[model samples]
Target: TLYAVGDWGQGKGKTWTRAGGVKLAKNGNAYTGTTTMTKGQAITARLIKVDANGKTTWDEIGDVKATADKTKTVDLKWTNAVEDTVDITINAAADLKTGETLYAVGDWGQGKGKTWTRAGGVKLARYGNAYTGTTKVGKGNAITFRLIKVDANGKTTWDSAKDRKSKADKTKALGVSWTSGKVNEDGTIPDDSAISISGKGVADGKLSIQKGNLAELYVIGTQDATPSDAVWWSDGAAVAVSGTGTVYGVQTGTAKVNVKVGNQTATITITITIK
Candidate 1:
């Protein structure tokens, strides 16, 4: 019998499994089995030989390395996995007022309890007008956080909204621009504004795309906004847009495309007509 082990296993103390055990081949020297794991993950397996009287012998230990097939969707197992420590760096906006202490609070240790009062806010250092800080969090898990400005009098004001990162890692860098704000009156953060889009190929607030064809449009934004701040989305099946404002007509139907940045949002309806 063969058993698989490592982070992919079921749970604590239940790490070993013979679920997909295989018998030795005709040569009586090799066996085969399969277990799915995420890309870049390393796993180990052991071959156990059980005799008639239940005596067990450990034969060989094999190391298995897994890689992802980008061409196909792979299921991920989240249980019994090790947590990686991720370092996060935050840069505050230029307009942050004086006497305000910048803080970082989220799902990690800085604010594990989810309450502002219990949140051990990590204070950022002031570098001229900008506040910066480096903090650690758990990788492969989201850290929902918001920039908070605490006045000398203990008054706390949150940024326009709470920003959440899906599966945070060491490579992520966050920027906080105090462009808009609403008091955390009820301890709830406001939603960030979306980007605005406009111009040619749009009619009556709707974009027209020929079925099985592609359409291009230029999105306009404020002088301070850059192309990197634009996020685009389509509400219908098969319709998609490139980061450079090029829309692909996948199927014949209507869809809504939304572009957002910070606290501004603009949406246009897409009408896909038969070619």
Candidate 2:
């Protein structure tokens, strides 16, 4: 409906007018009409949308100038914008290793579409079994994002969903996934890049052990449930992974192995003292 909003001599008030009504679309889907309540004066146009059952869906107002049969287009702007944020969680795929990196990309955070600055760096922190990120969108708009993994060798792995190339861009968020591996609930370490020189270091990214008989290098990872997938990696032949991180310490005296259980990196350098 149209209303004349001006000094009507009665303390400047607005009243109903029969000059015109907002016209609906041809198929009765949208509003597109004009009014001539008061020529050369400002007209206050109020449009109300209702459902088939007469339930009010939307109600907005717009001010337009009507001058001597001139139909000025009314651009209605809704003041009640959506102000809720969305929480997106990714239960990262398995096969993740310690010392590697997992990042979120494609516009999930303030990074424009990235969750971090570099591919080898992780910004979205992982908790329990999920990597959580956040974003805000309009009522009918969808959010987009994808997962990225940077391995020990600096190789990247994108989200392996739907051709493994498309970012998750949708309005619905409801799903589950598996973890990189499994963590010992009793693992003594508290953060990434940590190793256990027979349970000595916690959150420290480095440690050492002895030769032959000191053959075991156990990594009791973070206090949180992290994947113990860091390979039994080492430098040259200073030590060999006996399918269970067994050290030889016979042929070589120095070795360094890089691994991680979360975002940080841990390097285990063994300074073997020959027996």
lDDT of each: 0.51, 0.40
> TM-scores of all models?
0.35, 0.26
User: What's the C-alpha lDDT at position 266 in model 1?
Assistant: 73
Candidate maximizing TM-score: 1
Worst 10 residues of 1 by lDDT: 69-78
Error of 1 at 238 (Å): 46
Model 1 C-alpha lDDT per residue in residues 123-191, reported as the tens digit of each score: 777653445566777665566666777887889877676463434533234545554322111112234
Q: What's the lDDT of the predicted structure labeled candidate 1?
A: 0.51
Candidate 1: lDDT of 261?
65
TM-score for candidate 2, residues paired by index: 0.26
The reply for model 2, stretches above 4 Å from the true place, is 1-81, 93-95, 107-122, 137-139, 163-275
State which candidate has the highest lDDT.
Answer: 1
Q: Give the runs in model 1 whose Cα sits over 4 Å from its true position.
A: 1-83, 109-113, 162-164, 180-275
Worst lDDT 10-window in candidate 2:
163-172
